[model samples]
Target: MNIKLKTIFTLLLVAVLGTTFCFGQRSNIYIADKPFVQEYSIKYNFTNERVTLNSVVSDRNGYIQVLSSHGLLRPKAGQFLFPGELVNDVQYRPTSDKGITDADIYKNQIIYIDDKAVLSNAWAGNLYSRHDLPNAKLFSAGQDFTFLIADEMELNLLKDSETLWEGSLNNEIQDIKYDSENDHFFILSAGEIYSFSPKNNKLELVLQNDKLTCIEVAGKKVLAGTSDGFFEFDAKSKKHISQIEKNLPWPEITTIKSVDGETWFGSTQGAFKLEKNDKFSYYASKRWLPSDNVIDISKGPENSVLILTDAGLAKICRKEMTLFDKAMFFEKQVRERHIRNGFNATVSGMTEGDVTSGSMETSDNDGLWTSMYLAGEVFRYVVTKSEDALQNIRESLDAMERLYTINEIPGFPSRSFERRGYKYHDKKWRRTEDPEWDWKSTTSSDEAIGHIFAFSAIAELVDDAQLKSKAILLIDTLMATTIKNDHYLVDWNGEPTTWGRWNPEYVNARPIMVGDRKINSSNYIGMLQTAYHFTGKEKYKKTAFGLMEKHGYLENLMRPMSEIGRAPETADDWSRMLSESWNHSDDEMYYCGYWGLYRYAFNDELKAKYKEAIVDHWEAERPEKEGLWNIMTAIVGDNDYDLEEAIWYLQEYPLDLVNWTVKNSHRKDIELIPENFREQTIKEVLPPDELRISRHNANRFDLDGGSDGRSEYSAGDIWLLPYWIGRYLGVIGEPVQK
Candidate 1:
């Protein structure tokens, strides 16, 4: 359900009413009492010294039976889907001060040697052995059958003390596991595997390999762990099949387990999964494991994989959908809820009356926000050719074109629009002073850059003649106004807007080290190229070349970043402005402007220079893991660009879009750096939507604990843009549009 908080009821009821809101019909101004809050079904259970998983078994009914020192935990069917539900735990503390001595289960029965001789089964049997078996280290049970490996390498198969078969491998054994499929006990010694069958009272050699560590049976294949690699054999014919040693991240495999045809190998370094097709996937990041030294691997509920490390246990559930599924879902969400006619809704982050479920109402940067959405749809239509995508682009382009006309000025675009009765707490939304319509004035250069970026994409991609002409006209008007008004974005007040300073005098006045110098050069050149390419206006092309050759705009933009920021000695008015603080917003402008920079460059020489500049900017930005930057970099033909990191950014992004209160300042896991600008700490990306509401320009590492914990941010714009862009670039494949 889509929640749009059009009005605020009260602050006291925010936590009580939850993040979801019920709203009336669409209105010009929708006031929110708080931000939306999203609840996550995912959870993490951190195990400590008192709680540790030892062994795990999956029943036919899909219940995961966990054996631990604290007790045996049996999760009810479907427990993984529901949070806060308790699993059925049978209490039995292990007697060993260090760990469980022996434990195993088979055929709906179990037996173990903890402190005392203990046994359990469906028949309600209370059995205990009087003899002291202090050296017993392994146990297994099957339908009225039990086995124990004790003292030296003695193996005893017993039925009520009958001792059906007793023998010793005569060498110290490493580990043992019961292969229920063959109803036999597979034992591992220093360098070989032996299978003992109770049905025939016979011990047979399965296979021989050096430095054997562990073993597992998977259908027709027998997997053995060696000191340096993995060995596979044909289980039916006992024939050697293959050996794998090179690709393993860690060779000394301690345990091997299989689930749904995927085998998991646990080693001291971490765990690796061998898929059915024989491809390997590694899991070594601290985000996934409490400790990399894994001791055991077990089948978990809901097809999840349970890993017991030396420090704690982790349950990895494959719950996230494919990137394609999420991208399509976000596209639909943006289309239905985010797009207010053509203006993308943006809420004021500082407002207190925002609703928890809906988008924030704002009269700022609507053109910029909508332009990004428009570009996403343009890419979407290019790939999928869906009518919906085309229609969306048309609507957004119309809205953007309206920005130019809604105001009295011929080429000036309004920041945003609203109905008369609506006003924000900060008074940022002003009346066009028109009777029925209210539009914001004093739009910034960001809006203009966004308008040009989207307009260029539409003009180049959309097949509709009418839409293409309108896009070109808008570009011509915007560019002509800038060129005619002394290369400045004149505002309603007749003074240039604070951010609209592109005049060569103003841009060239700044020291080359200032970010404004390079940003203005890059943005102006990109804009002029876009206007000239779309409208075939010679003046646009001439002015662009004039700035490049006469003003050294090209060289200014190509300045080495090392000289960019050397902290201002004193906070001048310009230095104190938020835009001057590394001005991530400018980064957003530069990358978005790249479409025009390279794609519509004046010539091949200039195009190559633009690519070089973009690469330099991207090289500095790679550490941040900002998805849009990586995707856009790849789009510019950097095939060797970290495409995997692009996928990681998409996958690791949080599911919750709410700017929740997340605190990492005191966490032990984060490696805090000694810096001044932001809270730069190295840590795993928090679960989706768990972090603060971050703009594309914000640093990925900055920790944020939201103000009121109510705002639900719109992640659709950020995610959909790159996802569709990836699809268009062939880095990501397409999905069936539903």
Candidate 2:
């Protein structure tokens, strides 16, 4: 049950994140496959792959020049360079200096040197030195003259041999920039902003603060990058007005730049953009960048932003598109990247895999994972009427239905299936005595939940009579077998499976405090209702109502979530279940069973009670910010759901399907909730990959990690279920076409 339920939510999440409704404009945040690194020996090549990125600027000819410690490297004979094509190999004479101190693109040429200003055309292999300012530390190009800050505590503005303006601030300057509006050369010295106006040949202190680390000018405002984020100061008033760090996702702001009027923030973690509407968007982590550390940023062609990081350089551009376009892209990638085939087994998609190897070991819950895939296709067919979706539904349903007939048992579903000679360590595969195939037994309640959930979706959504009949037969057979065994799934060994018990004696035996009491109660009636609905069998309906009236299953299932955890004393029959922490498994069972409980209710009165119970369960789950639970509650329709929050979950979901090791245990950014039964913590949910492969019921705050930083499992059912449910419920409409 643990493996199956875990895989359902896990697989659904890792592989497929479709188009998200606009947070206004539909934009894609992506990491380039090719990073502008010295390793690539392209525009920013150094001696090796690793090098410090000092600066990046675009020249008048639209050529991008990147300055690094090794040198100012560009394409050999043209503007474009491929990875591994080194500077020397591309050009006979690299033209760039052996070592670069500082550089800027000035008037269609690279103006750079350690101690002199060399105006060089990289592609044309032309170089000219116009100034020899000894001990020159840094320089920025102005309209006619060049501004240089020397290590000898001197600031000089010169054109040719003529000195336009000269002054000494008496403080060591770290960086220098030209503000065209005021004609002031802003000097970052001693963590202060000092301006030298060549027009007036005078130096004046503009702003001083211990934390002023960097500076840039946009429009009439002087932007100061500091510990508190970027400070916006009016150039005319010279008074700080506002700080733009309110929406910064990462701290340790490193550099700030205005890209065509948009505020771009570079930090030790990643880069962020503060849009005009005061909202923030994040472009961070290895998935979105070569490295989290962003050192510098510059304007690129067509409003794009160029970013320089410790590992490489990248460009981010926004285009006008729709969510549906992205959804099609996602679908294509998942089909190409995630699909895997096992020896003699049906073709199926992996929940997650190694990004490099592109292979994933089979999981124990293949049945459940395949069921989710089937259900997703079912929903897709319902919406788009796509024949391909119908075909995918058929294939996935075949894989799921095989779980029943693969073994000798008439109605029992196998946990998974494999080839005859397949080798494994956890459990020996039974031969089924069928020479061609092998199957796993001891199916749990989670398998049943997945089977019934998927079959119900297919039977309800698909129009094919044969498929509907097949689903109904399998559901009825499974339900009748459970009933025949006193509401327990007695395995081939004639013993009840660990989680498939719903007998009144077992369901009613546990005290109200035990999680299984609520779990078994809800599933018992839910399963009975499902069987009755599809089969229209009086026996199934009679048994469902009888369980409610006789065993108080409705009351048991409806216990307030607050009172559902461990009580003052423990029972011998429920010793392991006795814990202060709320049981996540119980939550999974109740919610998974909610569909059967409400959708196929015996009557209207019982349906109302089920809705009330669902509302209470959703309220208890609100703090988790779980997209699945929230979307499931929307299906119940008892309360106004958080539609926006649900959309945020889908939108913020990372595109990279690989489960990279993400460590947030020691992060101070995550808010910690006071310790409670369910172990709730974190005011905001972390990225999906950062989270453990847990069922929907697990406490969002349960802090557990594995030694291996790789993700081998995913809760795909978690995503597909809610997305399909939303589509079916009309909460999410057809995406806008291009």
Candidate 3:
């Protein structure tokens, strides 16, 4: 063959092999082809002190009108336009010439009821056309200016200025809704559902249940909201279609309505949308509503849902976004407010969730957090070849490098560093030789393992020689120091930090059931393997084997996850305390170290063993559906590692990372289990948006916690790390095109 043709043929053959390999490795997990809907709130709080809102409606012109006890009120836009920003400037200005009691949207126009008449803006210009009906309590408007007006005892149907029919019922009327498809009105009294045919001018009883509160009609279906739950009925048959839907975020149904072919329910506790899968997307608390007491629901502008509560109005907006799109948003969020001296940090002490009023705070896990962020950027750079990711890597790597140099201890990384005299009341902060700075001491094992995880990733994945060498040197320094000092992180004071001990004396001292024994063993061996892999140091390998064979470190790490539980009562106070419940932080440390332990094993036999241990750990962690842990387990080439659950975690995570006060302990739907060793609070975990904004180190089953919007967490380690790593591992695919 000619040289050009031979070269092309070789390239084609390589490409075909690569494609086959990729398909073979592709997980059996079904990833959604379309983008998921990300929901957020745009709140319009109650600002008018003189008026109390009763009912709300939205017109096709995108105008929202509320019926207050005094008059009709319309919303005025707020100054701030950002998503998730609280719009307190929305004033409900009076738009009616007379006082109004109730209202509904009829043919894209507002039709309302007053003490003396039923009025509408659908007739002409700005003037409302009225049909006299005294003591109107409730009303609904149908096609061609037809109206169904109801009082306590009387029901009146009117077409324009002329009355079509009048009827009386035994029970007091509660609500009225016009069904365009059936050409009739579904009426709800205190206990009965009646279908009134306007064409025949007759009212016939459909069903009777004492618990019924309100009614709605969606095409051929009739929905009745009861005191306990809601019921669905076939409109044509006028019979119940199925059992009452009691499985909801909250029962005690208050109202029901259909918007854009979807049924929405308003309850005493919250508002929720009935999804296509027969599940509910719940909206409650301050995150999605002003109050839990939802008085009404309607369709709003731009594919949003307007929920009226006692405190104000909440516009739940839906936007179509892929997981990659969400990652980009969180990327901006981190760089804008979370980067503190090149280390990913938190914004704290905010005034009522305002991001601007917060200050970046130092943390004990600064090294671990910065390392996770750096590793994420490494994955991002490798996958996308993004210059921004490369720049981020360089900046964060500089911060990680300084952690060792900032302190006199050879490889003991400082917890954090800051300007001298800036930190207060913390004795852990010590003055460095440089008069301008202070470095924190008492660094823990988590920081040590996290540093190895990131440094080894850079040393192995990054092509830049200088960056690779720097990473390897850090690994060597840390592992050398640990081995030299007898498996402990010795501080400048010549004493091992409290939680940094990995000697057999400490590891074997704890009961076998304690998680510390396994976690510490796992981390130390991983660090040794990583050190040997990157620096080609034989001592690292020799020491790792010694610990594994002589010290029983391998047995400890390879112990079944089911065996971990509360330490024996005879054990030390520390061991007992550590095993009181599952340590989610240990889960984080184990997954982070697994990158090094499994990838840089001494041989294939140990690699297989490490994969077994790693998968066992992942099995224990499956209930949390943690994205990072599951995606990290993909390194072992498992066919199924809960990839869908991991995707759920990534997608369900809220875009607003502010530490809002989220409460779920009071919820009635979730089944609470008795407190156990794993600390699984409920039978099922709530979506991330319903829980507090927490890192992977926090328990996903934690039912309730927050700083009441007093802080915001960085998304770098919590979200972006998993997503970028997932993309790099090819467990998660690229963004789907529109």
- Give the number of the best model, judged by TM-score: 3
- TM-score quality measure for candidate 2: 0.81
lDDT by candidate, in order shown: 0.66, 0.63, 0.82
Query: Could you give the candidate ranking by lDDT, starting with the highest?
Result: 3, 1, 2
Instruction: Name the top lDDT candidate.
Output: 3
Tens-digit lDDT track of model 1 for 623-691: 676778877886456355666666766775654444445544433224556663433455334333334
Off by over 4 Å in 1: 1-300, 304-317, 346-356, 425-427, 567-581, 665-673, 676-693, 703-709, 734-738
Ranking by TM-score: 3, 2, 1
> How many pairs of residues in model 3 come into backbone collision?
0
Off by over 4 Å in 3: 1-33, 47-50, 75-95, 115-128, 151-153, 169-172, 205-210, 241-245
Give lDDT tens digits, candidate 3, residues 422-464. 7974768999899999999999998999999999888777666
The alpha-carbon RMSD values of the candidates against the true structure, listed in the order shown, are 13.1, 8.4, 6.2
Please estimate how well model 2 matches the true structure, expressed as its whole-model Cα lDDT.
0.63
How does model 3 score by TM-score? 0.91
What lDDT tens digits, residue by residue, belong to model 2 across residues 321-380?
A: 333333454455445544433111122232222334435445556666566656766776
